[model samples]
Target: MIYKVFYQEAKDSTPRREQTRALYLDIDAQTELEGRIIARQLVEEHTAYNIEFIELLSENHLEYEKTHADFSITEF
Candidate 1:
């Protein structure tokens, strides 16, 4: 499964640290259900922060990538 994670970094209201959060996941999976499960777990794991998730399915390879750019710059 190939997965791409898009996220953003921002300063939280508190002064301790910054936040890097997931916005979406592009995935290559054997089945739609598995992709959904992976996306759900990722969202669950980061629920405490301001993270969001989207899932897309492919069936070619098992690669995972992450990006931290603005959504407006990325072509949907």
Candidate 2:
């Protein structure tokens, strides 16, 4: 299955730190559930760094567009 990971920069106002990246990943996996798990694990591993995960509920064209308008509007 194919998976898309959307990440956003995280800022720690209290600590006065910021990360300079807005991350997005496209991955192919054997299963959707496994893909999500893998994405979760990646976010967990990067917790120490200034990284934040923005979960994608569905990869469906319509749904994905509703969630993110930055991507092309046409069906995927």
TM-score of each: 0.34, 0.38
Model 1 residue 31 CA deviation in Å? 1.1
The list of candidate 1 runs beyond 4 A from truth reads: 1-22, 49-76
lDDT string, candidate 1, 10-51, tens digits: 325442324444354554467877876776566557554433
Predictions: Cα RMSD each:
9.3, 7.1
Q: Which is the leading candidate under lDDT?
A: 2
> Would you list the C-alpha lDDT of every candidate in the order shown?
0.45, 0.47
User: How many Å off is the CA of 61 in candidate 1?
Assistant: 21
> Tens digit of lDDT per residue, candidate 2, span 14-55?
333253433344445677676677765665576543434434
Give every collision pair in model 1: 1-62
For candidate 2, give the lDDT: 0.47
